[model samples]
Structure formats: C-alpha cells, structure tokens
Target: MRVLVAPDKFAGTLTAVEAAEAIAAGWRRHAPDDELDLAPMSDGGPGFVDVLHATLGGELLVTTVEGPHGEEVPATVLHVGDVAYVESAQAIGRHLVTEGGAEFATTVGAGELLLAALGTGATTVIVGLGGSGTNDGGAGLLDALGAVADAGQLDGGPVLFAGLSSVDLAPARAKVAGVRLVAATDVDNPLTGLFGATKTYGPQKGIAEDRLYEVDGWLEQLAEATDRRTSLVKGAGAAGGLGHALLCLGAVREPGIALVAEAVGLASRARAADLVVTGEGAFDFSSRSGKVPYGVAEIAAEALRPCIAMAGQVLVGSREMRALGVENAYSLVDLVGEQRAFEDPVGSLQALGERVARQWSRE
Candidate 1:
C-alpha cells in the first residue's frame, strides 16, 4: 500500500518537516515494504515559508527583524520568480511572547520582513498570517511601513492605542500601491468584536478574560484611525490584526491551506496514494476552519482515498472526525499520556503513528 504522510507543525514541539519525517519513520517501522510519500503542510502559520521553500525550491532570504517583544529575531522570506512569501509567526508567533506580554507584543518585525520581501522586487507578496502573540491591531506593522501615528503609540501595545491621537497611512499605502498583497490566513474573523482577534485569541496569548473587550476596543480605535471598513473584512483578525493591516493596504485574503495545498501538489499526491494521513498539534471541530488536517483530508476524500489523522491531542469525537473526512483519528496524548507527549513529542508521535499504522496498514 502507498501511504502519504502529511502534517503541519506540532505547535511548539516540531516543525511540519520534522513531524512528517517522524510519522513516516514510524510507519516504515511497521510497514517497511509499503511505499510512503511525505508532504508536510502549513496553514500559513509557523512553517509556511519553510514548507513552500521545500516544495517550490525558492530563494530564501534571511534577515533580522523585530520580535514580538521589541527584541531582534531572525526571519526568512521565500522569493520565487515574481512572488514573495512570508510567515507572520516568524516575527510575532505566540510562543515568542512571555506570559503577560501579549498586551505589548508588536507586529513590527512582520512589517520589516514584508519590506525585505518588497526589496526583492517581487510584484506579488503573500503574507502567511497565524500564531500571533500581538494584539495591537497591526499598529506596529503600519508604523514599520511608514504609517505615522502619535510618537511611540504604534510602537507599543493596544493599551497605548487608547491615547492615540492621529494616524497617516498615505506613505504606507503608496509604498505598495501597484503591488499585489495577499493575506493567506486560516481564520475569517473580523478585526474587533466578539468573534474578533482580541476576544478569540487574546486569552491564549495571555490576555485576561476581563480585558478582552477593552483590548478589542483599542483595535477598533486603530481601525477608526485608518480604514474602519477594512476592519470588518473576513480574516482581518488573523495574526493579531496583521490581516487587517494588510487588508488596509488593499490585500485580498486567501485560505492559507488552499494556497499551501496547491503549492505542494497535495491533490496529485493524494490521487497517487492508497491512504492519506495528516495532522497537527490539536484536532478538534475547529480543524474544519481551513486547517492543514482538514484541508489534507478534503483532498484525500476528493481522491477517493481513506484519510486518517494522528495528532498531539484529539478533541473531536469519531463522528466529528468522519465529518472532517478523516476515517479515524489517533492522539499521541491518548496513546502515551499528556506529560510524555509534551516531554518527548517526536517519540510519542512516532509511537502513535506506529499504532495507527498497525490498524490501517494493509500488510
């Protein structure tokens, strides 16, 4: 049997490439004679650039940029023929911010990386938006791109936006006037409301529950200072409102997984495989929202192949899993417990892969 192993990054534990390798290794252990194909995936999150680079063979331009906490960090941009690709998480990933620092995290580095991509003379720039720690409604990003605001206001967090006086986005808009900016995102939430960036993602980034509305209001003020209409656009809330900023610059939104799937030729691979396996850090109902697992399973289903998922945790019931197009789902935590799953994610994931292969592998 031919098995296609594809997975997104295991959050903090592994990159998509590493996850694919680990799962493939385990599958080989159980079914050495079975052919295996590895196609790691990303939904415009942390491994976005790397996955694209691996499959597209693009030029990787490395540069130093501001991190979530105003620190310097390394990031990479993938430049292909006439387009450039960047991952927002490389600059503002949730893991880069410490507890209680989410309120102050900035997307400045992401803007800087965008500038670098622009410097490459690419006409089309695709920004992968997800796993962000900042909640400043992309003020830092606008500031980095020459959108002038009150001195020091756009440099800090949303808390500082309360006193924001004025914003001039002309220069930023002019910079990308003729360029095509695409916001590749996994989410479709608007910028500032109940289902928006702050209320939905701020808690995970360390914002207190009571502060959700307050922080969201700050983002609203940011939208008011710029383009209020763009704030309500789908995906405006992705990457801590980085999506909103890009949209403000006239960017169109695209489902990141769809973009990734096309770049990786996932459909053709699935068509050639007898079985497909895909996963991520967590598998739940939310997976249906353009995540890698759901996207991969969809492709597998289109190919009329059986699809299964192996993840760090499986929160969806079997019926829900089937609804996502996954024939079955396996959890590392369920197989080896939570403590071991985190302490030794690669090993635990490999073990889970082996167990799943035993049941699914046609030996």
Candidate 2:
C-alpha cells in the first residue's frame, strides 16, 4: 500500500517539512512495508517558499529590501524560469512583527521585493499574501511603487491618513503592464466592513481592538482613492487589505492551497496513493478556508481515498470531520495533553503518528 503524507506548518513549532518527516517516520513504525510519500504543503503563509522550493527545484534568489520597520532585510524569491514566486512573509510576516510595534508596521519591504521580482523579467509572479505585519491597506506598498505620494504617512505610523483621497495608480499600473500578478491567499474576508481586514485581523497584529474601526476606515479611504470597490470582494482583506490593493492594480486573487497544490502536483500523488494523511497545528472550522488540510482532504476525496487528518488541536468532532472529507482525525492535545503537545511537538507528533499507523494501517 502507498500512503501520502502531506502536512502544513505546525504554527510556532515545526515546519511543513519537519511535520511530514515526523508523520512518515511514525507511520513506518507500524506499517513498515507501506510505501510513504512525503509532500509538505503550505497555504501562502510562512512556509510557502520553503515548501515550493523543497518540492520543485528552483533558483532561490535573495535581495535586500526594506523591512516592515524600515530596516534593510534580506528577502527570498523563487525564480522558475519565466515564473517567479514571492512570499510576502519574508518581508513583513509575523516573525518580523512580534511586538505591538507591528501596529505601525509598513509593507514597503514587500513592495521592494515585488519590484525586484518584476525586474527579473518574470512574465508571471505569484505572491503569498498571508502572515503580514501591516494594516495600512497596502498604503506602504503603493508608496514604494510610486503610487501613494505621502511616504511619511505610509512609513511612519499605524493607519492614520485620511488624506489619501486621491492616489495616482498610473505608475504602478505601468510597472505591472506586461506581468501577471497573482495574490495567493486563503482569506475570504473583504477589504472593509465588520468582517473585513482591520476588524478581523487587526487585533492579531497588535492593533488595539477598539482602534480597528479606524484602521478599517483607513483602508476604506484607500479603496476610494484608488477608485476601487473591493469591500465586497472575497479575499480583498487578506494581508491587511493588500489583496484589495492588488485587485485595484489589475492583479488576480487565487486560493493559496490550490496554487501550491498545482505547483507541487498534489493531484497526481493523491491519485496514486491508497491512503492520505494531512495535518496542521489547529484543526477547526476555519480549516475549510482553503488551508492545507482541507485541500489535501479534497484531493483524497477526489481520488476515492480515505483521508486522516491530524493536528495539534482538533476542535471539530467526527461528523464535521466526515463532512470535510476526513475519514478520521486526531489531535495532539488528546494524545499527550496540551502542555506537553506544545512543549515537545516533535516527540508527540511521532507518537501520534505511530498510534495512527497501528490503528489504521492499510498493510
């Protein structure tokens, strides 16, 4: 029997590669003769570049760009001939925005990286759009690209500019004239409203909960200035309204997991597998939103394969799991308790992997 092991990053603990290795190792303990295929996955977040790089050999390019805090930082971009993949997290992701200072962070560094990718003469550019550290509605990115005129307003503070009533997007559009820009994200929130970018994600970035309205308003002002109506567009709120900005610039939005799956040929692997195992840090209702686990489960379902999902925390019960195409589910917390699960993720994951293999091995 052949088994496919595909998993996403386990949040603050292991990366997708690490998780896949652990799962494969554990499964082998019970099903020694089972053919195991490891396919680490990502959904346009922190491990996006690493997963694609690991799966598909590409030219990993590096360049210095302005960070979220205005310092020079090295960023990575993957060049696969005429196509380039850029992970925005390299510039302004959660790693760079731990403290509350991210309330005042900018995405100019991400813009600089995009410019560099464009300079590589890539006809198509796929940019990961999650795990950002800004809430300026892409104001800083536009500024770096010469669209927004007030660099001070963009680079200095949290969203405070009500004066961005009329931004000139000609320069940015001209720069992207021949290139295809795709914002790869899993978020479905729009740019403005109760469920929008600032309201839904601002607090996580350290923006005061009460101040979310102000930040959302700031993004709204940017939409108006750019002559865009992205408030109702799904995924326009991703990356602190960066999705809206990209849409305004004639770029398209695609689900991150789908793009990565296509890039990694996950479909063919799933079809060839007798059993599929996928996982993430947290398995909840939100996993339905184009996350790695969901994508992997869907692929398994398509190929008439049974999928088992494992996660650090599994909030959904069996019925919901089945509804999501998961034949079985396991949570680390249940296996070794939450504290230990958080402390020694690797050991706990391996133990859990062995348990699954013992109970459900297709050998």
Candidate 3:
C-alpha cells in the first residue's frame, strides 16, 4: 500500500514535516512493508516559508525585524534569485503578540522584511499574509516603507498614513521602484466593512467591542489620506488591513495557497501519486472555503485518487468535506485523548498513523 502523508503545521505543537515524520513512524510501527510518501503542506500561512524552503531548496536569510509589540524579533526571508518569499506572520504574528495588547501591535516588522528583500536586489517580493497580530490597518507597515501615519481625525477607524511624508522614499524607492510586490492572502475580506479586519478578527486579538468601531474609523481616514480605496477590493482587509497597505504601495493580490501550490508543483505530484493525503490543525466548516486541505483535495480529485485527511482536530465532520471529494477524515483527537495528544503530539501522531495504516492495509 502506498500512503501519502501530507499535513499542515499543528499550530504551536508541530510543523508539517515533524507531523509527517510522526505519522510515518506510527505507520512503520504497524505496517512496515507499506510505502509512505511525505509531502508536508501549508496554506500559505505561518509555516509557508519553512515549507517552501524545505520543498524548493531556497536560501534562507535571517535578520532582525520589529515585532508586533515594538520588540525586535528574529525573522527569515526565503530567496530564489530575484524573487523573495516572505511570511509576514514571522515578524508580526499572533503567536508573538499572544500576551500583548492589540492596540500597539503592528506590521512594521513585515515592512522591514520587504526592505530587506529589496536590499538583496530582489525585484519581485511575494509576501504571505495570514497570521497577523495587528489591526492598525497596515499603518506600521507603511511607516516602515517611508510613509507617515496621518492618523487623521483620530476617530480611530482605520489608521491611515500619508505617502511620502517628511520621510523620503527617494533612497529606498530608487532601490525598489522597479520591483514588483505581490500580496498573497487566503481571505477575501475588504479593508473596511461588516466583515473587515477589525470587525471579524479584532476581538480575537484582544480588541474590545467598543474600540472596534474606532479602529475601523481610523483605517478609513488613513485610506482617504493615502488616496487608496479600501472598500470593494477582494482581500483588501486581509492581514489586519495589510492588504490595503500593499495596495497603496502598488502591490498585486493573489490567492496565497493557489500560488504556493503551483510553485511547489502539487498538481503534478497528486496526479502521479496512487493515493493523496492532506490536512491541517483542524478540519472544520472553514476547511471547505479554500484552506490547504481543499487545495490538495482539488488536485487529488482531478487525478481521480482517493484523498484522505488527517487533522489535529475534526470539527465540521466528514460530510462537509464530501463535496470536495475527500474520501476519509481522521483526527488525532479521535484516536488519542485530546489532553494526552496535546501533551505529546509526536506520540499521538505516531499512534494515529499506526491506526490509519492498519485500517488501510486491511483494505
């Protein structure tokens, strides 16, 4: 039997590679004779850089960049010639700001990453914006890019900024003027609306309900000042309005997972594989809406291969994924106790792998 182990990072517990290794270990324990293929995956989020680096063999460059809460954090950029891949989450991710107040968190560090990429003489920069910890409407990012935050009116909607203010972009602009910027995002939300960044994700970032409207207001003012239209653009609200900021900087937007999948040749891999497996930290209603599993399942479905998913947790059940042609869905929590699994992810993954291999080999 041939089993493909393709799983996303288990959030804080394990990376996709680590998870795949655990699963392979478990499968080996039960069915040593079965062939197992490891194809760790990502949805163009936090682990995007690592996934690309491992699969594509890029040069990893490490540098110091500001964190969400004004602290310095170590960040990396993946480069292949003039094209640089950056994961914004590495600098200003929710994981970095989990204990900090949302009011002060910003994407300035991400902007620094862009600057660093430009410094490397890379003409094309691909920024993965998924796990942000800021709701400042990309004000911090613009600031790092030589734009000045106007914070006009102080209504606190979307914090807008003035492009080319007292700060001169002449030097940096000369270096990056011809460079192309691509913002890769998974969400389709606009900069400001009922489903805007602050409205939908701010609460989770510790922003109070009363302050939500203010943040939205600030973003609107910033948008107006910068002469960038915030509303109506799909994905304009992604990454705490980082989408809007990039738009203002003349960046193009693309579906992050689709782009990464194409870069990594997932379609061809799925076509050649006898069986395909893909998953993430959780399989829920959201999984159907263009997550990694859905992307992998699409390719597997096209290849007419049975696609199975192994997740850390399965919340939406198997029926929701049926339309996507997912043949089976298994959760680590289902095979092992949640608490114990959380305590020892590798062990849980190994056990889960053994169970899956036993079941598949029996068939």
- Compare the candidates by lDDT and give the number of the best one: 1
Q: Write the per-residue lDDT of candidate 1 for residues 91-146, one digit (tens) a residue.
A: 99887898988888888898999999999999999999998888888888898999
Off by over 4 Å in 3: 98-100, 149-175, 228-231
> What ranking emerges by lDDT with the best candidate at the front?
1, 2, 3
Residue 270 error for model 2, in Å? 0.6
Error of 1 at 41 (Å): 0.6
lDDT of 2 at 318: 86
Per-residue accuracy of model 2 over 1-363 as CA lDDT, tens digit each: 899999999999999999999998888888899999999999998899999999998899989998888788889889988999998888888778757765678888888888988988899999898988777777777777878554236554445565756778888888889899999999989888899888898888887877777777777777777756765688888998778777777789999999999999999999999899999999988899888899999989898899998899999988889888898889999999999998999989999999999888866
Q: Write the per-residue lDDT of candidate 3 for residues 1-363, one digit (tens) a residue.
A: 776677778887899888888988988998887777777777667888988888888799999998876689999999987789989999878888755366667788888988888777788999988878777767677777776333332112133332323223244344457889988988888887689888988887878888888777766655565544544488778888888777767788988878888888877777777788777778877876567888788888887888988888988655676976688888988888799779999999888878877777644
Model 1 misplaced regions, further than 4 Å:
150-152
lDDT of 1: 0.90
RMSD of each: 1.5, 1.6, 3.1
Error of 2 at 123 (Å): 0.6
